[model samples]
Target: MQKLSQTQFDFIIIGAGSAGATLAARLTENNQFSVCLIEAGGKDTSPFIHIPFGLAFLSRMTNLGWEYDTEPQSQLNDRSLFWPRGKVLGGSSSLNAMCYIRGVPEDYDRWNDMGAKGWDWQTVLPYFKKSEKQQHGESEMHGADGYLSVSDLRHTNPLSSTFVDAAEQIGLSKVTDFNGPDREGLGFYQVTQENGQRCSTAKGYLTPALTRSNLTLLTKALVEKIQIIDGVATGVKLQLDGQSIELTANKEVLLSAGAINSPQILMLSGVGPKEHLAENGIKVKVDLPGVGQNLQDHLDIIVQHHCKNRDSYSISLALIPRYIKNTFNYLFNRQGIFTSNVAEAGGFDKTQYAADIPDIQYHFLPAILLDHGRTTAFGYGFGVHVCGLYPKSRGEIRLRSNKPNTPAVIDPHYLEHLDDQKVMIDGVRRARKILAAASFDKYESWEVGPGPDAQTDEEILAFIRKNSETIYHPIGTCKMGDISDVMTVVDSQLKVKDIKGLRVVDASVMPSLVGGNTNAPTIMIAERCADLIKQEHK
Candidate 1:
């Protein structure tokens, strides 16, 4: 075992992900403070991570992500669903579908109403603009010179456009931009990409910051726990290449390990619920009851169909020639089928149960996606993924053991509430109507999932229970709230309650789940937190 000569830094960031990478880059921008970013996984140098279409195969690669499985959900036929989170330099941003969506303003406004001060729609909008570099240039709503590139997809399947038209045919408006004022409509989603390549946080933020003299990056380092002394976080003890090392944080220890790991790290550090810690045989440091509670995620159900036309993406002997031709097109011009994000088009709309804002979201894929795209399905087909935007059901993440490496027991308790189940049924029925529209008449063949036989509400609910999965947006494990709330782990400023020099800067700090894709919102949270930290230090 070897010991490091230098063991101190102004800030120590755990998990070099979307939030961590942004914080690391922003904190070290002035070179006045030193930062150390530690990641459990190795570098994200894989071609699959850079190429947009390569997302189809990312779920199968175990090394790049923590392939977590939820505990058997009683509400979903007792199925333990797969949950994949990136462990590499860019974290989930490198593995995500790259949909750059910031949910409507009401989402943030609700956060403020829920006791998270200074986090309303108007207050957080600047942070969203500050972190984005829109392809269409600067505006009141977007920034042109940000580090994270946001651009239109260089290529998209024709069926994606048809899906938009189908929505319009059903009286839904064709929204040009989902981020604009009017968000409830169908549209082709702009992605977090540049020149047809995925612009992960590793590419957009961390890569440029690597040359800074005051910044340090340690990959393949497993953080065992945070070291707290007298109710104050001092440093972290980690295992690096079979060697134990301790790195002290002079200013603060920022936990950006996302929803699951961030809370798990705090628990492992003995800063969680007293009873749970005692049960695990670990000495409790801070008895915070909300360390791993208030778990929220978007549960999705897919409505698939067989397409008579061969235009949809399919793996077969007939398409091999086209794939070969498109490969060269992408290599030379950075265009063609290889540039498609697969779930290229989507929409937001209100259901019968919605009061005002959209209650459901859609992601239309020009191919068959079964088992999180892990299972290969041949022939021409398409699918529309429907998910209720706001679910009342809540779940928790708990420690299975005292060991840091042991994966946490995740139980989302999806559809535990009757309202969530009803919304999902409505969402599926809405998707069926869109597919049945005239715009898809030429290509549509037959329903593949929740097929013609499952038309009734009971049948649809049963199908949802048998087939639903997470849309990869888990959050609120370590929620930010007012001090009066006993379950609140962190405050509005993101500092842990009653713990000095410790903060959580990730999706884990969200008080409620946003209405759309979470990648852009997660980046926005870090951008706002960076300024808050800088102000405090100054």
Candidate 2:
């Protein structure tokens, strides 16, 4: 144990990612309120973070990520899947695909129905609008004057457009916007980009507010535990550059360390299940049984093919001249191949398991992506990533030990439920159908993943178990619900049920997983939390 020196602020926010960055910026708007935003990783200075197409290389960079892995899931052929979470200032938003999706209205409405009051579509829509600066201008569904910039892709591979055409050929309607009223369709995805660069929360919210006298940003600071005295979270104890430091928050200690870290922090602070805490040699405090339970994530399987033409993005000697031209094009105009977010086009569709809304999602990449883009395939190719939107399977994050630096045991239990398995099979079949459409005749060649041999339902299930990986959307660890629900870790206000001056203001508080990407919705949660905290303090 190291000796600590104390520092104080009006609010101390853990993790300077999407939610924390937004909260730190919004809370410090009133000059009187001082905010300290602490991040485990260094600054978002990586060129890969800002460059839209750099995500392919970004996935392989271990320095910018938490570098977590699951506990060998049995359903997935006993494989331990890698979970890369952003450790940088903007967090995962800086490392994500930059797709600006806010799921369907029913997603939030379901949250309200699940006991999260004031979180329905109508109540939450304003916060979504408040956080977005839509390129198409303001409308009933969007806002034009917000911090995060959302724009249509300036550059896309020809194969991506062909994918949209192919989906249309397979009977899926062409949709201009997935965020609008009509959600079920295939089309190009809008990205969180401005001109060409990614509009991560660090760029959109934190960077502009850095010069503020009231805001303090700390990087490479790992929070060990919350300083909870008499069941009230007074501050946090963290390790900064091999030295221990205690930060006190006069108003509140906001935990926006994301889904994994948020719950892990609570458990480290002795706020988790009593039995589990005792096993890890931790003294019990709140004994919240739901601290690390109810973990859910989107598991994706790729349907890939070798392209007959050179239109797809790939590493080949034949494309050297094109690469050189694209390099200069990006350097001068911020356009060309470098401007493309690999998953350029995608769509939403309902499987047989779905009732009304889309239960399966597709991300069409004009390249051969393997191992989250960590493994490179040589030849020209394209792939469609498919994921079951609503997974019936549930997993949990548990402590490896009482130590904070030691990575937590993450078990997503992917494809544990029969319904999830069935949904994934349907999603893969839909993707294959679109790829086989007449529109792809010019570029399509032989199938790469789950080859032609995988034809039957049993074979498809086996292929899914062998090939599935996370699409990076994880939520519901510190679930929010009404008082009647025992699993509710936080209430509608995001405050810890029995703790004072503490709140979990990130994706963890979602009652259930949203229909699409979690980044946009996570920002909205923080935007709403800032207002909730302001009202109480005012």
Candidate 3:
């Protein structure tokens, strides 16, 4: 451990999240390269983190959550949105809804067209398949021997089934597998879990690699800045247990600190827009303007309905016995309400205004979720979340200060574009139709939010402006593209532009936002990145 500061390793991966965990594990598999994985947070041993249903309580666990908030959105009545990121070993993978969607083929093809060469559907599909251990068995579309677990939820509430049935009743066909032949239908989302527990990257990759002799895993290590000399990144300056240490990378320094931290680390190290760095008292190392630009995220609108049945989950004195039973059922049988990842069922769909693909996504929860689940309203209820997949609006992540602990300035600028608002309005209307179907008539009493009275487009628009929130998917701050693109921070190979021995390999490097969850794709990126690094040194 003492050699971390005195000797250089083959690679140093920052942020131990999805990409960092996968990249570190894959890089050390051959026992040829020594890898060091650094994480700002401690271990992923929190009892709430491993339980699938504990996500309900994770939003409030500040120790494990990097609870960030966006600047007041001008289009959303100047309301700041809550953004929860996992700060533990597995990163957001431990804090997410655990949906295992790889997005549609066109999503990657769009990346190819956007100047991220060799990242088209066909080229990237293999990586997705390579990293998955699907419970449904192996096929051309899925892998069975991979490390990450992909399985169907052990149990689902009846309301989730109703949501699917209602979607089918409205001409939206039912799909058994969203990651299969088509992603344009309704179904339950397969989660990243094994048995009844979560299979976060920390559990999937880092745990196994911990026993490897060549791998070094550091926890509670805050990386202050990259130690860049001339044009090459030599190492990183990080603080661990009140001690300042510098870890050198013999081969390369991989920055996988996610969308916000990745760009912030870059800028703090003097590798961002020259003027912005100068304004923040950071000397310019490389004037890369796209270091923290082009941020993309999904702004969700939730429609809630009061429940007519008492059996459904709710906060009530009468449910004390039920809660106790469910707890024992989960502890002993490993199956029950506690095993449910609140977002039990969800799917992707296309509106009439879609651009040749599914442009809308729905996450159906059997329980009410308000204020990012921060404010709980008593009584039985359910919610359906609707989010426009691809937003035209872009934002930025800037250094709030030079301090490593200082949070980055996140401005997602949601709904700033007129088209984003229009699509959301359409999404809300379609969500209402799904709820109105006969399938939900048995349990649904009435719409509690934006109620039945708010029917006009102006009314819907106004409702959206006041209530839209983030769905926790953020990407593309340090975008990857060809050299010709001025806004590209990293090249097609993920190398930091004009900088040697440095690379950005995380969601931040995504040229555009994928049509689905970012965790699976982020793991795939690290898998491929491991190959790239290995080939370069081979």
Listed per model in order, the count of residue pairs whose N, CA or C atoms clash below 3 Å is 0, 0, 0
Q: Which ten residues in a row have the lowest lDDT in candidate 3?
A: 1-10
Clash pairs detected, candidate 2: none
Instruction: Give residue 320's lDDT in candidate 2 (0 to 100).
Output: 98
TM-score of each predicted structure versus truth: 0.99, 0.98, 0.98
Candidate 1 per-residue C-alpha lDDT over 392-511 given as tens digits, one digit per residue, 9 for 90 to 100: 999999999999899999999899999999999999988999999998898847997999899899999999999999999999999999978999999999999999999999999999
| Global fold similarity of model 1 (TM-score) | 0.99
Cα lDDT, all candidates? 0.93, 0.92, 0.89
Better of 1 and 2 by lDDT: 1
Model 3, span 1-538: residue lDDT tens:
3345334788999999999999988998979898889999889999898999888888888899787988889999998888998899999998999999888888899899999998999999889988999998899899998889999999898889888888668888888898998767789889999879999999998889999989988888999999999899999999988889888998899999999999999999999999999998998999999999999999899888887687556788998998899899989988988888879888877776797888999999888777877887688888789999999999999988888899999999898888998899999998888888898878846898778888998999898898889888899999999988889999889999999999999999998999988899999999988889999999
Native-to-model Cα distance after best TM-score fit, residue 237 in candidate 2, in Å: 0.6
Q: Judged by lDDT against the true structure, how good is candidate 3?
A: 0.89
By lDDT, the best candidate is: 1
Which 10-residue window of candidate 2 scores lowest in summed lDDT? 1-10
Compared with the true structure, what per-residue lDDT tens digits does model 2 show for residues 222-250? Answer: 99999999989999999987888888999
